[model samples]
Target: MVLKTFGWSFAVTALGLVAAVLYGGWTAFGIVAILSVLEISLSFDNAVVNAGILKKMNAFWQKIFLTIGILIAVFGMRLVFPVLIVAVSAQLGPIEAVELALNDKDRYEELVTDAHPSIAAFGGMFLLMIFLDFIFTDREIKWLAWLERPLAKLGKVDMLSVCIALIVLLGTAMTFAVNAHQHGGGHANKAETVMLSGIAGLITYLIVGGLSSYFENKLEEKEEREHEEEEQARKSGKKVTAMAVGGKAAFFMFLYLEVLDASFSFDGVIGAFAITNDIVLMALGLGIGAMYVRSITVYLVRQGTLDDYVYLEHGAHYAIGALAIILLITIQYQIHELITGLIGVALIGWSFVSSVRRNRELAAQEALGEKAESHS
Candidate 1:
């Protein structure tokens, strides 16, 4: 059972370990181990969010996520993506960027670090959209009833999330942009760059989100039509439980997941530089962490954990919101990874406890009712 469920994760980790040991000796192995743990600790909430989406996809797509998708997450995001960022931002060719990373680690790190403000802005805005949309939308059940109720009411306003996110981005940019100018030292363009980066992020969220939503809706409609036809053809009434949304629908969902993963990786990649300038070490460490997260995602789906813990989704989104805010703040300041990881884990831990308490209450009520029925 363990192998069937977590085999891919184990395989990926083994490969990553071999690669790490081959490329770097025992000392590098230790650093990779530490970084892997750091990433996993920081991204537990990310795994929850991923499971929420992954469960909605078809089984074929789910397998793809584990197999082909893992390759993208590990190599594409953890490795090539960083090099691409440096190449674009530093105006160097890909070969030169790789060369610089291998030859001049400090300079490469500086180039990556220099781009932090924009990276933070883009990722913050994108993730902020995800959080705001979730909280503001109408839901029959409320997690934090007192807090969520008012937010739901506010959701009546057209595009409330978009407006609020834009206002926050502009406000932060204006405030910090000025501070960055004086203290930032030769970084007078920080404000403009931050604003532009935020806008870019907002645009990315809308485009990707809009496309995914459109495809999902169309797939739903197609399924509904097929169900109706099948019911009509049957002499007796029946319902269709599964859907066959295979091609375009799957592609859009795949796109959405990749983008979401990229957004999550931005913080990790930036923070990894703080620990090590060795690109190979960072990739190997984070790649192992990525595999475990994906395994946890599949486990959550198969176990139906989301259904069991109703408020867990709320907690994950709240964590994402907190991370988004942290990213925005880090635009002008350097926040330690430990602090960032702690904040996310704390919120999720509280939510899990709340879910357990609620479950026990429900169970006790059922037991009491069953006892009364037996007596009657």
Candidate 2:
């Protein structure tokens, strides 16, 4: 299974390399390959988190994630989104902005840099909400139930998340607004725009995140109830059919994967700015990022690694929380994304090794029990 999964990844990686060479040269190929590995390492947590959700989805949705979902990741979020941000911030038309990006690379970089405030604000808040919602909510696993209880109690206050979001909004407003006057005359207006953009980002996070949380919770509850019903049927000696996803469930899964990919791509897309403003280079980097994320999803599914690492989901959520905070800090500080990616890879790698050791230990214990029983 591992070989098969790796075979597919190798094939995709090779295809990307070849395409890069054909389009640009050896430099492009090398860059794409390096960026792909970097993205894959950084996004291991994304794969684990995706597996936690994907297990609830059927095979059809999983395929959609590998197919149509890639389009959104590569083109929609990675390509068009950045251009749109540039256009909106620079007061240029979208087509003109894209042309400028494809032609005048220097200007493109400047525009993207200028637009960083909004990008950081949007991606930061979105990831923050995701991290907090997962951390604060209860899960089926009881390993962290004790920690969850306190958070749940806090959440019972009706609008804890909203209140926290408001504080973040105000803080961003004050920081940018206050600093705006230090630049110059027109610079002050720019600061107001930046502050307002930050608030807009926060508002976007509240709406999308709240709705996603609602649906996620509802689906989880429904699954639990169904599981209970199945257990009852088993107790009654009746055959209980396994629940399979289809139709709307598949659609929802696709949507979930898309959103998840979007979140993961935020860092890579933003970091690509440090490399080159050439849309082609950006696409190469982002495309490689997309390819590896898709490959990781397939790797998890094919190897059934999710079944082995019970704590893997927990680790991923924690990593997501860390990434969120890192992104927020990057707003003011120059946080190298490579550091963030390396940390995620290290954590997930540790979890994987620990899971393997525990599984081996369990197998040995079982073997010892069998041997003793045979002697008896």
Cα lDDT tens digits, model 2, 1-376, are 6555456556656777788888789888777766776677777798788877766667777777777877887789878988887798779998898898888877777777655555666666666666677666666653356676788667667667656765775676566534432111222324455456556656666655555556666677778998999999999999997565556656665665676667677787777766656677567666766666777777776666778776676678778777766665555556777899887877677667767777898899999999999999
For model 2, the local distance difference test gives: 0.69
In TM-score terms, candidate 2 sits at 0.81
In candidate 1, stretches whose alpha carbon ends up further than 4 angstroms from where it belongs are: 180-189, 221-245
TM-score per prediction, in order, is 0.92, 0.81
Write down the RMSD of all candidates, one decimal each.
3.0, 4.2
lDDT tens readout by residue for model 1, 140-258? 86789999999999999999999999998998788765555222233544777789989999999999888888888877767778778887756466653545446677777777888
